[model samples]
Target: MLREYLQALLFIFIAEMGDKTQILAMMFATKYKMSQVLLGVLIGSFLNHGVAVLFGSLIGGMIPANVLQIIAGSAFIFFALWSLKEDDDEDEEEGVRKLGPVFTVAAAFFIGELGDKTQLTAITLSVDAAHPFVILLGTVSGMLLTSGVGIIVGSKIGDKIPELFMKFIAYGLFLVFGSMKLYTSLPEHYINIFSVSGFIVFIVICSAFLIKPIIDKKKKGEKSSYQKAAMTLHDYMNQMKSNFDNICLGENKCGHCEGQNCLVGYTKDMIKEGIEQGTITNPIETDSREVWAKKAFDHAKIVDSLKFTLKYLMDNYKDLQKRDMSNAIRNSLEMALFEETLEFHGDINMYLEHIKEKNPFIMEELRKSL
Candidate 1:
């Protein structure tokens, strides 16, 4: 019983890792608190997987255990192939915001999982299990854990975890476990060298057929000039942000005046005081004001460049499918540019005031700096 439960948990956990629903969870995190998202996931997954397990348990009792294993194994092989298919950008959150955070997430998730791969996986795992309720529990736990990961990736970590890598890992696991099940469940005479080799060749051919399109699409996308430009812009912004944050020597270490008090202003004041006291003759040579001024000017140019690029991308988005600018990536770019604009246009106090309710720590740090 415990073995079956663990198997269900492990299978569901890996299957959910890079799936579209996880991505949706990440997107939802941008709009709601982590705790509310987690609670909704738990409730939604429990209901969805509970129904799936019930259906599968009934099917299990009707069929022979060996037959059920064969079916389950074959289904997993199909799932491995299905994983290569790209997910559609379905607008799952249409008009659901009025339900509040927890209910909105719960409703969205429940609807999303109606015929989703994870729900199908739960049914598959439970079809041969002796304890369907145990499978339900395991699958629900898997969803909660994976949703937490997605939320963390979206809100705190950003693009540190590559979605493509996670997809391949999930695909490989499904393939391996599926093949193992078939090997063990088949008759001993049917699993001889000749048959096994033939099956292996078949799997390889089918996998190649499924994988070739993805590779070809990527290759074709690489030739797009617009794609290259967008990628370059993205990389430049990330590097600039990193550099700006690393140079801070303030108490909050808030990235060269990302807080209320500006380090540039402080440095300028100190330089002025030094000159007035006759301790410094050349302000240019006595302080870093010149360097800071140049950086500020350069930052303005960068912001202007980004605004142009973003506007072009938005206007020509339909014509540039190869650019692969996902909503998450675009949103990240927009937010970064917005914050930079706030800083550059001297509207940071307004921006901070808007965010003060959501992130009180920034206000707290501002007080400390003052």
Candidate 2:
């Protein structure tokens, strides 16, 4: 049982390494919290792989072990060929957003895995196994592991890893396993050197034909929606910095300089006002970076404008991404609301309400972090 579980886990893990479902997880991670995305993946994998294992186990019971091996081997070879195919950049038309983040992700993921290679691999692994339940567990574990890595890579690196390279590795693994199974399962007469050589030649030709388009597409420098979306966020950050649009003062464009009209002065005024209002206490770190953030947040609330707060968040988020900070970008915003020494910036609750009305997706992400 242990051997079966580990084999199934490793097989599915490799099968999904660069699969479209992994890509989907990465794309969703860019816009959602890691915990929410991972939870959704867990739920979806459980439901999808459960059914697959059940079906495969029934089929395995009815067929002879050798026949099942042949079928499994053939399916693996087909998966290798399928790995060369490019995924369509389909947009989500389903109304999953109405159900909230967890359900939205679960629904999308379940739908995506209905006929995905990873799901098929789960079924293949279970088709002749002694323990189908263990296979199901292993496959789910594999999905979670791979999807977790995808989320981390997406959040941290911004698609620096090439999708083509991942696909190549997945394809090679599938092909190797499939060829080995066929070699061992074939009749003694069919296991001759000539037969093996001819089989290799056939696979090589098929692989070249299937892989050519993918190679050509990569050479053409095409970008997926996920990559484009990541680039858009980076571009927004760069544009805001270059134009000094996120500065505290609307007309001041010194870009965080120490000039009289710069953010430092704006922060000084906020600290004074907060102290006068009995909202701030002693031991305040005057030179802390978060002090300016606190001021921007508080000022935005006082004036009933999200402009400064939003800009501050965007700027901070860009810096965090660059530095790979694990802390949330809204730490100062939260402090303004809850910390006694910090002046309560604009109603964080009100800001959440506004965000929900204007952009529910961002609102959902915000609520999750908070």
Residues 172-284, model 1: lDDT tens digits? 98989888988888888888889989988988888778767656755553222212222332343344344334434444433444331233343234334332442323222
Q: List candidate 1 segments past 4 Å from native.
A: 154-158, 216-304, 307-370
Q: Model 2 misses residue 228 by how many Å? A: 4.1
Q: Pick the candidate with the highest lDDT.
A: 2
Score each candidate by Cα lDDT: 0.61, 0.63
Residue ranges of candidate 2 with Cα displaced over 4 Å: 224-370
- Provide TM-scores for the models: 0.62, 0.63
lDDT of 1 at 312: 36
RMSD in Å for candidate 1, one decimal? 14.0
